[model samples]
Target chain A: MSERGKPNELGEYRPLSYFQLMEVSLRELLVEKGIVSDAEVQATLEDMRARGPDAGARVVARAWVDADFKARLLENGTRACEAFGLDVPALRLVVVENTPQVHNVIVCTLCSCYPRMLLGLPPDWYKSRHYRSRVVREPRTVLQEFGLRLPEAVQLRVHDSTADMRYLVLPMRPAGTAGWSEAQLASIVTRDCMIGVAVPDTSGSE
Target chain B: MPQVAARPQYPTDHPSVPVRFAAGDRVRVRKTFPLGHIRTPFYIRGHSGVIERYCGNFPVPEELAQMRSGLPAQPLYRVRFLQREVWPDYAGRADDVIEIEIFQHWLEAVKT
Candidate 1:
């Protein structure tokens, strides 16, 4: 007998989920009406997939080395990013600084309204209901779970991206990497660091 | 004679509410439950906080979600509330806070 339903690349055939079915229906409808071509949709998806946290790391590194750029970033995140040659249209960007006295984290209680242009897509946990509800209520506890235990003396600022505005955490530069170049410094700025769940560690850097 | 400064040119047709609060101003999130794409989180309703910054005006998200022109843009601000105040049992420093972006329509000036 022929293999049932022709196994997929993973050697398994499964039905599309509800949301997947809806997305396929919508895309097909749009294509049928000539609203958008299939190629255009594919290209857009490819563009989105190509984006990563490298741009955000570069911005963070630049801010660490240049006080003026850091001030600009803190003042107007969108414009500062545009000046950096990154296209972040429509959505308003807000950069929160993590100083010695305060630690900043980002959350979207309503939904996951992240700074996608800078940091690409958000992580799975960021979109989870658990993280959304708990982070705002018990930040230190949540941070502790992420292996980021803040001292009682250090204040925590949790930003809830509830509206059109998106937030990016400007984590403090770790010491001992004093004279590192921007590219070298950026290497230490991980995606989690920009999300405020982790900080840049120089131990792994050369 | 003091020279009068010229007012900056603004589009008369632009739909925008006047900015009422500045940074450092204390305001309370309006406590109301209206349906339809409400951006204001329920946890923050009726809470008092200080304005962290004026985030300029933007089209109302609720209206936009309804496929309506969110014209006469509403002023948005980052309101900062102490975590302890937001949650009585908040497990963090007293200085810990949460900043949320709220539209002007959802905020009221704290009565002095």
Candidate 2:
């Protein structure tokens, strides 16, 4: 279980951080102690991998098509998501609406607390120190870095996902998307759009 | 295998402590730096804001993070603060705001 100071074929040794070493020790102890089986860990990994932006896209697309569903989602996010067969577990999900005048962005300053059941693993940049620190102070500038330039009139609202609750931004439906099918609309909703960094390009669907 | 008891569920409607603030209430975040894991960010500490919504009552994360019984659930509120207020040199528009979910323990009602 101890890989620290282990020499490689190239006669080079790489040291693991205290946190990494503790993680390895704890994991091995758990497996050896029969608390968590290797197969169970693999299954959990597979489950996490199976979820992605596609699920979030489906929810957003459904909300766009059904006003009642959108209301439920805004009112009770976790329950509404369960209607779509998404398991929310003990964590509560809050869906913030992006209106014509207000845009929403999500960040976790303390740690990468995200809606993994819906959005999958957050992008590397989302977990970076720069994104966590800068997004709250200068959201507009951060959004601009993502190539999303909002009009001056649109107010920027950054949601700091700090607690046990998870947040998902329900971006405003793009113009000219009228009469668009749910599947068609879902295809245009990228991960960045749901994260509030980018907007769905409606012209592509047309 | 030890028989595990059903875990306690802390619902939003039922809070262990008395909720002093509600949505639209003016509140100021406490500036205390308690040891162990905390959800309150440093930037928001000692800052004033308005409660945007009542998120729900849940286990106090500070205790939960230490693997202790997060008993006596605390109310969590979504507080909205202007970016300019949070940062002195905030380059964003004055109208821009950031919302953070904070526990009841870290907030005090502002004397409006």
Candidate 3:
């Protein structure tokens, strides 16, 4: 046994990822390194790949059209979810509304506590530690970097979702969606809108 | 009540069968004491918010790392909210909405 994960001065062993393991090529290396197995890795990837954006999309789509639904979301988020045909039995839910006055963004400091149910798998940026640590303190600058300019009048809020209560962004309806049907409204509901970075606009979405 | 472990290790990957919450679906975040490996941040717990976006289901990172509960990862959402509503008398900017990623395990139906 040479060693495992991090040699002191003589250079014995060290921790590694898949790419790293490929370079070393040692079965014992895997056992000692505790690398995630191919079976597990394959399963995780398959599981992730199997996930769809429809469930979360439907929630966002509904919020875009129904006023009463919006109100209910504000009042009782979990209950309101039921009106839209969601089945949330034991888990707790919280609603976060987006208005012109406030622009909200979310990040997970520990790992990534994403609203996957409503939005789907989080974008690459959301998982980056850069977005997680920085967004909480400097959200305005981050949003600006993402091409969303905010006014001095509008405040920027950063929420870190932990273990207890999960959050969602109820974006303000776009200017021209008054006559649009629910399907139409949902179509324009971009992931960014749900994230509160940009409002839903048909040009880019279409 | 069986005494819960102070902190337990999570699993790498488990099959997630989630029950989703749709828009206008009123919900509340149950206040749970910190336990095991989890991804939900520390700042937004307890405070109530609204559902903004329904992100598609995916593997929960903390769960995948085998650092938290073994519950299979499921679909999640990106909810939005007002800064004023979450925090009061805060004079940062006037207009700001808070968006977050909430999992299915932490949601409860809001009673009308």
Candidate 4:
């Protein structure tokens, strides 16, 4: 039954697809090495990705409208995020605020250490070693890959979170958001902006 | 006798510490010798700037990411920087912050 290719979600587990292929290879390795029951490892990884929390879009949207709450989130991310029960066992939170004179860029040097409690699963590119290695070596260049080119004067704060504490990049609210609710704003807070590749555009949004 | 591989003395689940710096304080990236494997990023390892903000603490990457089931570990921080400060050629873009994570030991206070 398992071999019939009726997996689940987004699409069936096709070995031709990159992620699926990788999973297949890992399963083979686990079995070949006698590390664990082949079925057990596969189920675990699938469950982690499937059951992970939804990107904390609700809170981000709320913070856009609620100043006091934003302040609290900026100060204590873990504690503030507790309201949503999105805490990771070994993870800490760092919320980088965007100001008129400063923008924030985040990168995980060692691996993909993201604040999954709020952001959900990381994008495929983030998992690539190129992004992890290149982001630290040339952040601006890497950002440019995502269509972001920062001007020279704006101070670039490069955050390299390589520990248990993960980071979230708070985007400056785009203008023309007049009367727009937090829910609407959070929808615009895509994973890219949170990672410092793109900025919010009120005139035209992502 | 066939050589048997010895297990790693320190694995990713090993315990670690909390960061020691605060937000709004000035910090410079210390010059560190690269090792066989490391979590310290290279771009700003030897640079200097003010700690525009303080992110929370977390476990050092040396032992966090690869944990089998993931371990309950230390906190991490999100340190901010001015692009102009980091790169001399950086032109004022009105808003450009380089937000990165660095553990406690990698930071040093800058004196006036």
Better of 2 and 3 by DockQ: 2
Question: Model 1 segments beyond 4 Å from truth?
Answer: A1-9, B1-14
Write candidate 4's Cα lDDT for A1-206 as tens digits.
14524555766765456765676687778789999786787686676667432355566776788888788777767666776565545546667777776667777766777777567788888879898776654677777788887766556666776544567777887778878876678767777778777886655552
lDDT of 1 by residue, A95-161 (tens): 8899989888999998888888888888999999999999999888888899988877788889998
Colliding pairs, model 1: B15-B72, B15-B73, B16-B72
lDDT of each: 0.84, 0.85, 0.63, 0.63
What C-alpha lDDT, on a 0 to 100 scale, does residue B60 get in candidate 3?
A: 67
DockQ of 1: 0.53
Off by over 4 Å in 2: A1-15, B1-15
Q: Which is the better candidate, 1 or 2, if ranked by TM-score?
A: 1
Clashes of 2: 0
Ranking by TM-score: 1, 2, 4, 3
- Where does candidate 3 stray beyond 4 Å? A1-47, A87-91, B1-112
Candidate 2 lDDT, A1-206, residue by residue in tens = 33455876788888887987887788889999999987887788788777788988999999999999999998878889898787768658889999988999999999899888788889999999999998898788889999999899998999999887788899888888888899999999989998899988977657
The residue-level lDDT of candidate 3 at A137 comes to 50
| TM-score for each predicted model, relative to the true structure | 0.91, 0.90, 0.54, 0.64
TM-score of the A-chain for all models: 0.93, 0.90, 0.72, 0.73
- In TM-score terms, candidate 1 sits at 0.91
